[model samples]
Target: MTTTQKYAATGAWNEPEGATPRGTVALLPGRGETAASYARLGRRLAADGYRVRYVPVTLDDIADARAAVEELLADESLPAPRVLLGSDSGAALAGQFVAELPVDGAVLAAIALPGSAHGEVGADWADEVDARTACPVHRAVLATDEEFARGAIASPLPWETIAIGAQDRPTLALHGTDDRVTPLAPALEVYARAARTDVRLVQGGRHDVLNDVAHRSVAATIVLFLESLRLSPEAPPIVTGLG
Candidate 1:
């Protein structure tokens, strides 16, 4: 659970003691989210041999956020095959990064689409938690997180500018069938523009797919994607049907 900070409250997790590092992921937290929001995700990916650097992005100053991300990606200590992973508004930023940066790949989860009904804040704390995630632990995380903007889930994002766009890099798009903030239909439309995208939907998942109840499976899917990338940037599947 080692960490380093510079531009913002960033968090970094390294690979396990004796394992060869698989790759590096520059993670961008969703709107109103802090680096702590991804503690579980960071630890999980790191344990599986991938280095995870949670880089918090601020909408208040897009320039600063992008600069922070660029600085992290330029860090030679992180290893190659760098990937951009983002959820919610952060997912939108990942889309922008993969298109503009030199990253090898991207993972977009619960992407906040343009014109989607994410503007109205939830009625109360309990309702907000329900809309955000179904995982009890994650619920507690949000509840106690004084820094977490409680109703940001319902806040409108600049989807027209930030929504994912066509990109040449290997991309993985994840969404929840039960996502209330941004429905699946429009998100599908968004990913359809990128022919190289690998899309997966979590059953009964809420807006925060990365921290939802099926987080383990979601993380495994990401690992498989990473392994595929290790083999080739095309991300061919390593395992196939039993002979």
Candidate 2:
């Protein structure tokens, strides 16, 4: 069964049913994305016997993203051992929220690293930087990605701080080896600072890894990681080889 509801305080949310309610996995979409973007993934999780909640975050609602997450968790009516799955800007927001919440784990895809959007560069330099940067650069280079244009990049908060602060929580950082949007090098640096070992770099994968063929494997890995935590929240981190 699937149910769609409006989270007056957050935005729209889609809830999918499952047997025994394995647990709720809050799906946070990227910049300029709507809850519908996660429909496929949410439905997949729901079919896999896990309750899935897709949350939409827009530019105007970015500031309330964290609060919205808190509100979702406060419901108490949901199942236990909830996890957060976020991409792009949503990944950063998830990290910040987890630091204040009691989630069982998190899966971050196409995570933006600190300084990835900082510094001023000319169109030519931006183009050059995009070619050399680890994450996807087309968006940043073209200055069309709303996340960067809407002042999201200029925010003073550091990604390192958020990652490090959530050190104790089980986290899975998924990144595309050739992601030009969110450089992989800076993301790895932040992952290292957090001493996190559950990082996966998918080869030939782009920023929209969630929609790629590798999504199945990625989702399976995430489910396994969540299950491992369910059994032992303090289990040792399982790091997969970089693709």
Which candidate ranks first by lDDT, i.e. highest? Answer: 1
Candidate 1: where is the Cα deviation over 4 Å? 1-10, 116-121, 159-163
- Colliding pairs, model 2: 135-179, 135-180, 135-181, 135-182, 135-183, 136-179, 136-180, 136-181, 136-182, 137-180
**Residue 165, candidate 2: alpha-carbon lDDT:** 45
Candidate 2 lDDT score at position 110: 76
Q: Pick the candidate with the highest TM-score.
A: 1
TM-score of every candidate relative to the true structure? 0.91, 0.71
Summarize candidate 1's per-residue lDDT along 1-243 as a digit string, tens digits: 235232124577889898999899999988767876788888888898999988878766767888989998888888878899999888888887787787899999988865644524467878777888899998877777788887676666643444455467899999999887878887888788787899999999888899999999999999998888888988898989987
Error of 2 at 195 (Å): 3.1
CA lDDT for candidate 2: 0.61
User: What's the CA error at residue 100 for candidate 2, in Å?
Assistant: 0.8
- Model 2 per-residue lDDT at 12: 33
Regions more than 4 Å wrong, model 2:
1-18, 58-63, 114-164, 235-243
Candidate 2 structure quality by residue, lDDT tens digits, 142-243? 244232333333233333344534677778888878776666777777666554447888887666566554667777777777667666776454565776
Model 2 TM-score? 0.71
